[model samples]
Target: MNMNKREKIYLIAIIVLLGLLLAKSFYLDEYKPVTEDEILFREYVEKVIDDKFHGFFSRSKLIGYRIVSIKKVEDEGVSVIEVKSENEGEYKNAEIDGKYVAKIRKYLFHVLPYGEDKILSRK
Candidate 1:
């Protein structure tokens, strides 16, 4: 290809501008503001726990459950919520010293923010 000085300068400017644009896009995307809905998050966690332990535990036992912390993690461009909960209760067949003992049970849950109905893990 035949090019003059003006053409060469224009081409260089275009390349530099494109590079800057690309960099700006990446920077903006990386720091994009994320929306966190506390109510929705809590509701989702409760619904998940209820659905999983519905007939397994008495209502009284589950009533003591409370969320300890909720954190948002970004992995592979996906928004994941990590929830930690603690409850003081006695489960069926769980006895210590020949008697049911009240103990703290920790629960961990991983949820996807894309859809509140999607739960990644529960422990």
Candidate 2:
């Protein structure tokens, strides 16, 4: 079929628009809410490590104190932390410091996108 000039132009425009929209959807990865639990869990790991390095962690002598577990808890404020201890079995009640929590927030929004893991990389 022979098409008019205007019709051909319109068809091209529609194709371009659809391609752009498709690319954007793939880039966005949908609306994923990280939730308070995920944030809290990440903060817990950073805090626990900080404490251990500063000599404030008492459970250092435990078996699994070196292993950091970051995950959202089923029933609790945000997420919970569980550290494996040698003789003590598992260490609980891992607390996150205010500074470390802020650091995690920065990392998630800014740093992770660029494949940077540093806390200040978000800037």
Candidate 3:
């Protein structure tokens, strides 16, 4: 069946709107409520990362710390989390200070450092 000119225009407009909505869902961050289990997990993970950060920088003081994001590892019972932090300290004669980022893996109740800490800034 041949659609009228106006009908064709409307169809195209509707499709474009639908496409935009789908793209937005993938590109934007949707609001997700914090759940009880997620809260507990985050608190536990934060403590684990905090200890590791301090241990890695013995004389450093962590000024700020946060978990950037958490993602599940395939079908496993493990999660990979990204952490961002800022700290300052003195080592030898030089001052160590910077913003840092790290990824860690959590399985059950155990947490493991995943990779090297990335220094975002230092002077």
RMSD of each: 18.8, 16.2, 16.0
Per-model C-alpha lDDT, please?
0.38, 0.39, 0.40
* Candidate 2, poorest ten consecutive residues by summed lDDT: 114-123
The residue-level lDDT of candidate 1 at 105 comes to 23
Better of 1 and 2 by TM-score: 1
Q: Arrange candidates, best TM-score first.
A: 1, 3, 2
How well does candidate 1 score on lDDT at residue 7?
Answer: 100
Per-residue C-alpha lDDT of model 3 across residues 11-80, encoded as one tens digit per residue: 9999998777555433432222264434434444565555665643333431323354443223323333
- Model 2 ranges with Cα > 4 A deviation: 29-123
Number of colliding residue pairs in each model: 0, 4, 0
Candidate 2 clash pair list:
62-86, 63-85, 63-86, 64-84
Residue-by-residue lDDT tens digits, candidate 2, 18-84: 7775554344422232655445445445555455444422234311122112322233232235444
- The superposed Cα distance between candidate 2 and the true structure at residue 23, in angstroms, equals 0.4
TM-score of each: 0.30, 0.28, 0.29
Top-scoring candidate (lDDT): 3
